[model samples]
Target: MQATQADFTVLFRLLSGVVVLPLAELARAFPDEKLDSDAEDAWQSWLERFAARVSAEAREPELRVAEMKAANPKYIPRNWILFEAYDAAERGDYAPIHGLLAMLSRPYDEQPEMEDAYFRQSPSWARSTGGLAFMS
Candidate 1:
């Protein structure tokens, strides 16, 4: 049987079941990382329970991935676009910025006109600038 023939639901559930340890590790690893004070306080108040929940969610990889993807994205306005817009702004041009905003508003769709440029795979500059291909 090929991998796809496997029960994906069961596979994902099993994956989630195994996420518990990592989540605990992550929480411990990031304890000093600054976060929203109120949210952090609330989270810490129930850290143990929440950690268990995180592990449970991880057990269901498909659901976990879906949840994150829903909250995140697979594309974003490239930094080059932002730079172009900023440059245009400095020169009193707004078309680039306007076009970029429009593209951002419809990120999922492949705008053929932009395929040659903005639609290409994210360039290295993005990573260098700490911009991910996927926006949150």
Candidate 2:
């Protein structure tokens, strides 16, 4: 639920500058778990109210996203990443490790190129993957 909230919060702030993104759109956050209908409705109703209140007094969209990203990092070395890095290392490929290092070097910065590659939640398969360590 924490991950879902974080995803919703970021998206809320992202679209908050212009308009409130509907709760239906936040389904992307539920990668691992999907809320039941009652829970989903409750969250949606609550978030809609909250987003409405916030949007009424929001700053410019770009400025809002910039401030949020500046304060919160977009990248972190998650367990899945550690798994991938180590797996590559065991195969004598050190590039994943180097790439992980480079990505972590600017955790808070908006590395657009790394967005699809690194800036995302863990996939379902990650549940079975063991990692060496975690870093942020």
Candidate 3:
């Protein structure tokens, strides 16, 4: 099922035990007139309904850490990292490519140093910048 901001808010509240009112309600409770809007209210209602539907599903299966880690890798190469590696290879520097290969070799193992460099979403600058960023 498609996820939405309201669904995330509800799930967060359920897991964290924090009350997160809808933005529209928050806008009403707080004196921020700018934050309150008809559009936001409509969106909030839609999200609440979606969240309700999702919450009605049976509880998810709980897996042990080892089993979970085996099913889900600790690292998956991000597009921007691949782009950087490819770009460096084009410029006669193959270190990035080799490093990426090493990381991929043991995908389930936690590589702390590489986490900050390789496992992440594309940076804002790389988005729609064209070339390898868009290609890969």
For each candidate, C-alpha RMSD in Å? Answer: 14.1, 3.9, 9.2
User: Residue by residue across 8-63, what tens digits does model 2's lDDT show?
Assistant: 42343334334466666555445543667876877788778866776676567567
Q: List the residue pairs that clash in candidate 1.
A: 15-59, 16-58, 16-59, 16-60, 17-59
Off by over 4 Å in 1: 1-75, 122-136
For candidate 1, give the lDDT. 0.48
| Native RMSD of candidate 3 (Å) | 9.2
| Model 2 vs. true fold: TM | 0.68
Q: Per-residue alpha-carbon lDDT of model 1 for 1-136, expressed as tens digits?
A: 0211222222232233333333222231221323455545554555467456776653565577555445443236555568767989999999888888887787645466764455333344553555443331
lDDT of 3 by residue, 1-136 (tens): 1222122222222222212345443322121223335556665776577557546646542333345456556556656678788999999999999999999999877787876554443455565677636522
Per-candidate count of clashing residue pairs (backbone under 3 Å): 5, 0, 0
Q: How many clashes does the backbone of model 1 have?
A: 5
Q: Highest lDDT, which number?
A: 2
lDDT measured at residue 136 in model 3 versus the true structure, 0 to 100: 23
Off by over 4 Å in 2: 2-19, 32-35, 56-63, 128-136
Q: Evaluate residue 5 in candidate 2 and report its C-alpha lDDT on the 0 to 100 scale.
A: 40
Cα lDDT computed for each candidate against the true fold: 0.48, 0.63, 0.52
What's the alpha carbon RMSD for model 1?
Answer: 14.1
In candidate 1, where is summed lDDT lowest over 10 consecutive residues?
Answer: 1-10
- State TM-scores per candidate: 0.37, 0.68, 0.49
